[model samples]
Target: MVAVFSEDHVSLRASMKGLFAQHSSESEVRRLMATDEGYDPVLWRQLAAGQELQGLVVPEEFGGSGYTWVELGVVLEEMGRALFCGPYFSTVVLAATCLVESADESAQKEYLPRVASGEAIGSVAFVEASGRWDEAGVTMEAKKVAAGYELTGQKFYVLDGHVADFFVVAARTSGEISLFIVDRESAGVSAHLEETLDQTRKLATVTFHDAPARLLGAENSGWSILGRVLKLAGIALAAEQVGGAQASLDMAVDYAKTRIQFGQPIGAFQAIKHMLADVMLEVESARSAMQVGLAAASGHEGLDLDEISPLVQAYCSDVFELASHQNIQVHGGMGFTWEMAPHLYFKRAKSMALFLGNSDSHREQVAKALGV
Candidate 1:
């Protein structure tokens, strides 16, 4: 069965939109981006206490809202529209999903409540220096120790790693890929912030030198768990890209309608009209692709997420890149300035395009899945 978009979802979207408009304004995003923590703690708490946003997909038994990915996609879309500078994507989408999918009840009971309440922040350390997001990319070694295990290796491009309280780290255990939970404050664990194209989202390089860790799921089964998490993360990210594309279109259209040129609004020009129209088409089509991902993620029958996830990711990434670029073109010189919002969206588009994997890589995955 296909997932239905209900009035509740509409109401939730409206609520989140208002919340972000107030708390995650352009100025607020700029301010938070420059901060070390990279997000407003007060707003983060409000999301958990008032909106229960952090627990949207967490099961009810673990103090979460127990909602499905469809609702979570709505929240993420609004966040993308506002360019929210927070660790929600890392803590909820990446870390929480890993734990939930691992099927380790002990791990869930121990850590999920804290995540659901926003009392603790978490992220995943998956990619290494090679910058590959696949099973072959995991080279961090986890050796058995008297206490449990000890990890020694480094991870790069870990989203929000500097601010995370703990990490769901992927490492090689006995020559097999496995998952481990390591506290940020653990001995021999260090994180350093890294410069990135998108300032709104922070990335970090984390090194684990004999850091004590606890096994998350069954040893040697991490790649399977991570595969499911990546699929869900791809769907969620597609929703975010759709929102950003729409925002870019809105920004361009608004500027065109007001910015006067040649004795009339620039929107009156055939060139500007055609450009905006093309952006609109792309945005609308990207929304459709995002919906397909959401449906597949929400357990809609007869949908193969492995196929849909890559397709959605590739299409949305391309559409968002085009929309943001066209938004800059519409504004002429101002769009290129650091003061304008177009550059912000453009940077985010470029960064997100490479986050999980690039468009070409996703397309290759789709082709491989098709056995072509």
Candidate 2:
């Protein structure tokens, strides 16, 4: 079941919608995507200082507003709706959440304040060449050194890695999985941008050759910590997917209503009507799943996040892809052109489905959780 929204939630949504409409329009998105940074630094600072969105979930003592996951979900949904090209997911959802979920309060205190104030950008590096999101995929070695620890391995498809100030990396120590915090400027560390299907969100191949690192949480407990973080990430991503799906549906419907064929609007046709109706149904269903997932993440009673997170991820992934594809179909030839917006959403949908584990993998998780 979807959670009911309060008046504050409504106000927040409206404020975010207005902000994105002005700052993250299609032209601005195109401009930012083509840049080396893939986002606007000025706007990022505004999000932190003016809106305090970067610290939405960070606690009060950490220079944050101490907001809950539900509030962050609201911001992410608006970002997805606008196709805002930024490191928000990498920083807030991945890196910040990793710090918050870790057992090390020192790490949180050291990092969360910078993250909240937007003084630094952070990302998580876990997946290797195998592109696996599970603990078994973490093959990077972290060896104890006189100074601290040294990490030696490569992490592929790290979000915003090229520009991240720091990273929360997963590595193996004495054959046990562990997490580490590695500075971007650490000796023997390098990040190379990789060509991706979605240029709006950048990915990089990060190499660590005996790079200095700080241990996060307890040894051999990285998987458990990461499990909790990934569940929240899945829920957050599902909310974003729901927003994107709704935007795609809206675009398709608008195009169908205006484009003329046979002396009538294309939307008047039975086939088009049915197609849009189906898209609407899928989008709404995805939204409901996302809301339920968010509720589960918020510790709502009787909601098991282990089951709901994967379910929401799988369902939202499929829905967003379908909606984006149908949007292109609705636009006909114009959608195929670079000047149009449908292709961008389509690419984002496809790329996001693969991130943090694809729909098929999530489905398997759901099956395992349900024992079905």
Candidate 3:
């Protein structure tokens, strides 16, 4: 049996890495970046065909191995490092987490197994025009109709909205927030892809014009569910950011050791040494924070991360930001060019750091958690 750690993961990661490395050639990365869909279908099928990533978070009963979140983190880090262009994050982590956060047994039974089997794609449609990730930011209203509920409002910056078959939308009903499941093909539902700086990850403007929606939980009890969802998403995103940061750090280290300047490898120079050491520190620190966050989310019991969650996220974001710029700095002019993949990783880092919450926002949360 294939393991999920060091050797097994590395071996599995190698194959996927080769696939991405082949496609990340200057021309291919640039072309895919410019395209509206932002990913190649052949590569997508390859991910599904191997099911190389199927067992991480999914429970065994749902046709998955029920492995630890850290295993998923390993895959995420490698994928982010390669600037792997795909829906794995938005669909698997973001949407799948939302499904697990839902307390409704009927909903989970109806959806998660399909996700585990790779038969359905879902997205967390929570953010609005304000880009707020909380209940107060949800202004979309759901009114009860004989058919179910009529949803009327908009969700902006929804990740993978253009392709998600089902959307876990946040809406207000009778002065409270709730999770609603809406079919993308249903009448009154529409979405258009949004232009984003990181083309590998797609964003979309979603509109719900009297769209009929099914409630996933108690009516008007959305805030409680969303709070839990946010915590889970925070942990997942923190993991992804950790993954992205590790990539930059690795690239910087390898480049520093090989690139020659002043008749010697730059790795011998004090300045380059300092930068690589700093990158190492950031990667290790971020990894520790992410591990703790994931452990807490994995139900270690009585571990209150209300305060710790944002700190890890903010810390990892800082790590990504610093490591990204440094990756470019270390490469000098070559890094600035589109032909090198350094800029691609840097671009992706910048975009993901801002999502969920930026370093600044997480700092604010850290303070809030302290009751200051």
Candidate 4:
């Protein structure tokens, strides 16, 4: 087989960006944001055929592109820059990761191939009504039945929940967390797709009443897998933030260079220069943090990597949020308008940070991991 990355990754990133620029325009974005689907299937298919996004993590033996988290990070960063809305995160980062972490080889064989080929869109249904992100937040129960495990209760804030072909649900079974894969249109499974604050991303509330679900791994051993999924999701989210942060910075720089004040370009003003300088610092520092965290995640499996995960998540969230806010301020009142896409990215930054655990949550995790 060919090497995973050499010039390939760079070419992949560039091609994906070219695709984004080709397909993503402000009007298309506004139309996309207003839809309940929250994504464009045509665009998604284009991505799968063009860049092979859905196969980033799936093994080559299973019909995947077989790239590491770093390559995944590169493509995702470009997507973020374009504010591309789709199931890439829901299926690849969340659901695919959940399945990959499962101990069930049969399940992987059945699901990972579909996910890799973009034949199935899988999503994680872990959060509840109150929208808690912790594993302990799961109150849904599962019971073993002759047919299959029966599930009861609901999941809220499911990213891409309404449209996913299948779902990886976290449920309490025998008083312990377990993973289950349920077809979305299966009996007794219902989802209320709702309008969300971030139009670029979709959310839903899924209710289950004796829904038939196939087991993912060893029952009662799910929290461990969920924990690993969260760590990797954090890295993916950080890479996403790096894209948003740098994009925001670029937008601000371009505006500063062209937007004129009384006599000259507003960028010549001390205030704007300092603001740009500060943004540069935040972006670079966050980039470093993300790199370190990515290293920690993909490093030697048994190596004692310590608190790198939470640190990266916390720093990345803050830096992206900062960059988004500054980008708006730099653009003046025009930035606040819907005609401008600043708010799209800014909203995305906020949602991504909060979804896979946030700055504060990751910090607390870091403390717990540190035993402080």
Each candidate structure's count of clashing pairs: 0, 0, 3, 0
**Model 3 misplacement above 4 A:** 1-31, 52-55
Candidate 1 per-residue C-alpha lDDT over 1-372 given as tens digits, one digit per residue, 9 for 90 to 100: 254579999998999899999998999999999888899888888889988989889999998989988999999999999999999999999999999999999999988999999898999999998999878888888999899999999999999999999999999887989999999999999999999989999999999999999999999999999988998999999999998999999999999999998799999999999999988988988888888899999998888899999999999999999999999999998897989999999999999999999999899989999999
Model 2 lDDT, residue 69, Cα: 83
* Candidate 2 whole-model C-alpha lDDT, 0 to 1: 0.92
Tens-digit per-residue lDDT, 1-372, candidate 2: 666478999999999999999999999999999987899999999999999999999888889898888998899999999998999999999999999889589999999999999998999999998889988888888889999899988999999999999999998877888889999998999999999999899999999998999999998778888888999999999988888998999999999999999999999999999999999999988888888888888889899999999999999999999999999999998896999999999999999999999998999999999999
Positional deviation of residue 183's Cα in model 1 after best superposition, in angstroms: 0.7
Clashing pairs in 1: none
RMSD of 4: 2.8
Model 4 Cα lDDT, one tens digit per residue, 225-304: 98788888887888888888999999999999999999899999999999999999999888777766665556635433
Question: Residue 320: error of model 3 in Å?
Answer: 0.6
Estimate, for each residue in 49-146, the C-alpha lDDT of model 3 and write its tens digit.
56546435866665556876656766676676667666777777877766666667788778777776666678878888888776678888889999
Residue 274 alpha-carbon offset, candidate 3, angstroms: 1.2
Segments in model 4 whose C-alpha atoms lie over 4 Å from true places:
1-8, 300-306
Question: Order of candidates by lDDT, top first?
Answer: 1, 2, 4, 3
Candidate 3's TM-score: 0.90
Q: What's each prediction's TM-score?
A: 0.98, 0.99, 0.90, 0.94
Alpha-carbon shift of residue 178 in model 1 (angstroms): 0.6
